[model samples]
Structure formats: structure tokens, C-alpha cells
Target: MAFVKTSGYRGLHVFAPITPTREFLDVRHAVIGAARELARRMPTRVTTNWWKEERGERIFIDYNQANRDRTMAGAYSPRPLSHAPVSCPLEWSELAQTDPHAFTILTVPNRLRDQGDPWATMHEQPGSIDVLYSWWESDLADGLGELPFPPDFPKMPGEPPRVLPSRARRPD
Candidate 1:
């Protein structure tokens, strides 16, 4: 898995390179499928819940970022935070020991000279996302399906109702 510190933000933006053979919906489905599997495998640590109230203490996947028109930063992109933190790339081995706040506009130059670029060959061998789509289909058969979209997007087919569970009108 590839992850970058989001300008010293509390969370990391995680993703992988795909072959770019699918459209938006298909890619989203794959992401959801993969996230579900991850949540299942590491139930206490990860989640795919769209609603913050339901996520409990897990690290949410934020799969909605898979939606079209999403915005994300690449390695070395600066964020408009007070300390001028940059979206720093990471090696898988060092992720546990690394501190997001340590990299910034002033420090990254020295870091690059010391460690080289972790994302240098990221796109060299694009992998198929097809297996994740297959996981999506399997999930569908098991009654798991599309998730809720953001407020600005159009409702999608097979999507669960937009209402939050706590606020859904109950039968009288």
C-alpha cells in the first residue's frame, strides 16, 4: 500500500497505482470492495463506514475520495497549513517510525538527498484492479453493496438510502 502524510494532517492518504482501464464507478466499486475485506480482516483497526458516528475507533478508509472530481495531493505538494507541511511520500518499511510533521518545505530537501524518492518507480508496473471488482461482485452476492455518496453528488444505483440511521424516520 502507498501512503503519504497529508501535509502533517492527522491522517494519511493511502492508494495504489492501477492500470487505468476502468471508469469512475468501477474504480469506486473496487475500492469499496477492498475496504470491506480489509475491515473484515482487521475489524478493530480499520473501517469502511461513511458515517463518522458508526466508525467507532477504527481508521476509516475514506473511500469516498474515490469519487469523481475528488482532490488529492501528490508527493511533495505543499498544503496551506501554518507550518508549510508538504505531502511527503514514504517507504513501507519506515512508515511506523516516521513522523508526518518532520517533513516540510525547509526540511524535505535534506530528506530527499538522504533517502531518495520513494515514489520514483510507482507507476512503472501498474497492476490490475479487476480482482477488487470481483470482490465487489462477491460482496453484492453476500448482500453488501454500494455505499452513500457525498451530499453534492447524484444518488447512485444500488446505493443505500442517504438518511443517517439515527435520523431515519421510523415506522409509527
Candidate 2:
């Protein structure tokens, strides 16, 4: 759960130390693969940058907080509530057992911290494998509609437009 640094575009800083099972591959590869899969499911963009590291690998995913808000009409229906419910990570040990190949079924806005650092962490596998099986009992896909847009967001069409405030007037 180490905070890397704030991204140039968004306020979200790059976080690392997400303990995972045996990581024979590089961190960027794993993260990019996961994010690519996420892009296939959602209507969002993702980016990554490489930085120097001493030991274990580090992966970074940058997303716009503003895009979180959009029309959720096609999401959940029949249900009275506007959004669906989601579940949190069961435990750190549980996530360790999760099959790395399994496409994560995120019921909630997943935080990287909960996933643990795959670069340095280790756990038993095969028989007694622990995994954070996201509760898919409910329509969590529908619940994604509940998330609100980021704060101080500009109401406009197309990639959220940005505008700088006017400069202060100088005294005479």
C-alpha cells in the first residue's frame, strides 16, 4: 500500500506493493493485461508509465475520475434502487489464492491496495490456494451505475473539457 506519486493528468497517484502470488513475469505485463481486460468490459481509457525500481516490479494504471459518472440507464432495471451493491475483498489471504489467470469479477470499485503486491508476496498454491472470490451473487455490473462523477467536474460533452480560472486583478 505504498503511494508512488501523483500522475500528471489526474490527482490519483500511482500506488504499489500489491502482493500477489508467484510473479514470474514483469509487473507492467500483468497490470497491462488486467487493465486491457477491464477496458474490454467498460467504457474507459487506461495508461501506464515505466519508472526505475531497485527490486520487485511495479505496475501503474491511470484512469480519469470524471468518467465514473454517466447515464446508467441500461444498467439495472426492475429494481427500485438506482444502483446495485458491491462487496469488498474478503481478506488478504483469500486474494493470494485467487487464480492469476481468472479474470477478476469486480463487484465494487477495486482498490489496488486490497490486491496485495504480487512482486514480493508469496503463498501456497494448487490444493490450498487462497483467492478473493468477488461475490457475484448480485448484479454488481448494474451497481456500477451508482458511482458518481469526480468533484469539480466540467459538465460538457466529449472528453471532459477543462478551463483555467481568470487571473486576479493587480492593485493600481
Candidate 3:
């Protein structure tokens, strides 16, 4: 697991890679649980601009990034958005002092030349998601179930009805 602060915001972003599995929703649940747990341990905040409005502080796990079809920008790849910013990786300790704007396409190469890749040994050891899955089970025992999926995905097994909460009809 890795923690990063989003550029231009005081929000936390977590990146967790799990072994290949067909149980996508289960993975999503576990990841969310883990994010919540991490949030509880840290002094940071999480926010989501889901509906064009900032939903105030909460642990917002980006489970959609875990979807099979989705992909994130590579560590050194330049974003197509403004200023040609690059998605640079950083050491966990550097989080407090690092500025996102300083690591752009033109500056990353020199940075890399001066200091080798922070993620150089990232794949030397593998991690298991078993503990997270266990957390998933514990959350289930406490009555928590699946969270919402992207609107474009087909209705999945055990998924809650896809209606927006405001339009959802409550049980009679």
C-alpha cells in the first residue's frame, strides 16, 4: 500500500495492488475498509467532488480505479491536462515537504538523474490481500455490504439497486 496527497488539495490518495481475482466487488470492499482504517490512523482528510460539489471530509476510497478496464497514469508519464504535469512517485517521508508542481515533465528527468527511482525495489517483495479480505468478512459480519459501482457497468450479482439515492424508492 502507498499513500499520496493529491496535488492542490489536502486529501489523501491510497494505492493498493491486489493479486489477480475475479471477485472485483470483494476487492473493492476490502480496499475501502482498508482505506477507512488507514484514515482512522492518520491525521489527514479525504474528500470527493463526485457531483461537481465537494462532499466534505470522509474516507473516500477510489474503488473505481480497481475496475478491470480502468488504468492509472504511469509513474513518469505526463498528464494530458494542464502544464504537462508528470505522475511522479515519491517516498512516504517526502510527503510533508514535496510540492507537486515542482515535478513536471521538464524537471523529472533531472530529479531522476540526481536521485534514482523511489519505486526501484517495489516489486522485490509481493504482498497478500488476505488480511484485507478478512477485514471484508469482519465488515460483513457487522452488516456492511457492497458499495456502488460505476453507472456504466452491467448489473452485477449481489449489487445494490443502481438507482441514485435521491430517486430510489424506499421499501414499504
Every candidate's CA RMSD: 1.6, 19.6, 3.7
Q: Each model's C-alpha lDDT?
A: 0.83, 0.30, 0.64
TM-score of 3: 0.77
Using lDDT, give the best candidate's number. 1
Report how far residue 20 has shifted in candidate 1, in Å: 2.0
Off by over 4 Å in 1: 1-7
Tell me the lDDT of candidate 1. Answer: 0.83
Global fold similarity of model 2 (TM-score): 0.22
| Candidate that beats the other on TM-score, 1 or 3, i.e. the better one | 1
Per-residue lDDT for 1-172 in model 2, tens only? Answer: 3222212121223233344553422233333344434544553343222222311233334323213342221111122323332222223344545332222223223434555433232222222111211221122343421111234555533322232213335459
What TM-score, over all chains together, does every model reach? Answer: 0.92, 0.22, 0.77
> What's model 1's lDDT at 39?
94
Query: Which runs of model 2 end up more than 4 angstroms from their true locations?
Result: 1-5, 8-11, 20-25, 44-172
Q: How much is the lDDT of residue 157 in candidate 3? A: 67
lDDT of 3 by residue, 50-79 (tens): 322334555565766666677666677776
State the RMSD for candidate 1.
Answer: 1.6
In the range 1-172, model 1's lDDT, one tens digit per residue, is 4535553576787768888899998999898998998999999999988888888999998778898998777678877889888888887777898888888899998989998988887788778888889999999999887899887899888788888788989999
Worst 10 residues of 2 by lDDT: 128-137
